[model samples]
Target: MAQAARRLGVQMACWKAWECDRAAPQSNRLAMMAGILAVSPSWLLSGIGAGPLELEANDRAALLQELQIASAEAVASQKRVQQIVALLGSVPVAGDSP
Candidate 1:
């Protein structure tokens, strides 16, 4: 966000204000911001032009499947890590009396 603010040549507070609708970007800044955000200037100004890409139904389904698989893998990995931690907790230290 800081980097983006720098690129837009505004302070972070100013950027945040625009984001929160507490302030609005000037005309020139609007174009720069649109470029930085990869949206059309018209869209940025009035929400009337090319905006973010919309995923097709098939693409959305594929992405959903991938995310689900990654989530399941993460759960499995977490369980394995917890098991390892429990095992380590029971192991005796090298210099400790058994």
Candidate 2:
């Protein structure tokens, strides 16, 4: 768990501090799960139960829109790279096969 947190750029000190503040560190597995999920620990530790985190409809919609935009940008970038590679291939090189 510590290694996973480190890989996620979370410091050991922060994890220890969070563990110290919790009344039942062992019982509050949700907090640990939140850390693993890369979510806000407070949302998990202070919630009604250890169930999955809930996002507001608006927030979810915004996130979906952002993902769509990112996907479109990636496709455009890939197409541009393919065009550049094709252009490069058309250029004759010294001692290259016809």
Candidate 3:
């Protein structure tokens, strides 16, 4: 559970730490389970008592755009690292003459 939180970049404090402004520990536990399963927190807790929070069309679009940007950046970084590796390999060693 902690490893999953770390992979998602969520702090353990978000799940374990006591916060006066937030929900209680039980609520937090439910929320954590929902997060792990990628489902609605309320739905996970209440079993369809209240409807799920629907994402707005624009919000979904914005999220997709952000994901695309992140993917592009990751690919660019990988290419840059590969280029650096190739450049390093091309450098000749002084002790080993061709």
Q: For model 1, how does the per-residue alpha-carbon lDDT over 41-66 read when each residue is reduced to its tens digit?
A: 99977799899778999999999999
Instruction: For candidate 2, write residues 16-66 as lDDT tens digits.
Output: 665687433343554555767656667556654344557899999999999
Score every model by TM-score. Answer: 0.51, 0.46, 0.45
Tens-digit lDDT track of model 3 for 1-98:
58755754567676444333354446656676666656777766556655445789999999999999999999999999999999989998799889
Estimate the Cα RMSD of every predicted model relative to the unseen true structure.
8.0, 8.8, 9.9
Task: List per-prediction Cα lDDT, in the order shown.
Answer: 0.93, 0.71, 0.70
Question: Could you tell which candidate, 1 or 3, scores higher by TM-score?
Answer: 1
For residue 17, model 2's alpha carbon misses the true position, in angstroms, by 24
Q: How far in Å is the alpha carbon of 77 misplaced in model 2? A: 0.7
Kindly report which residue pairs in candidate 1 clash with one another.
none
Location of the lowest summed lDDT over 10 successive residues in candidate 2:
22-31
* TM-score, model 2 to reference: 0.46
Give the poorly placed runs of model 2, Cα more than 4 Å off: 1-36, 40-53, 94-98
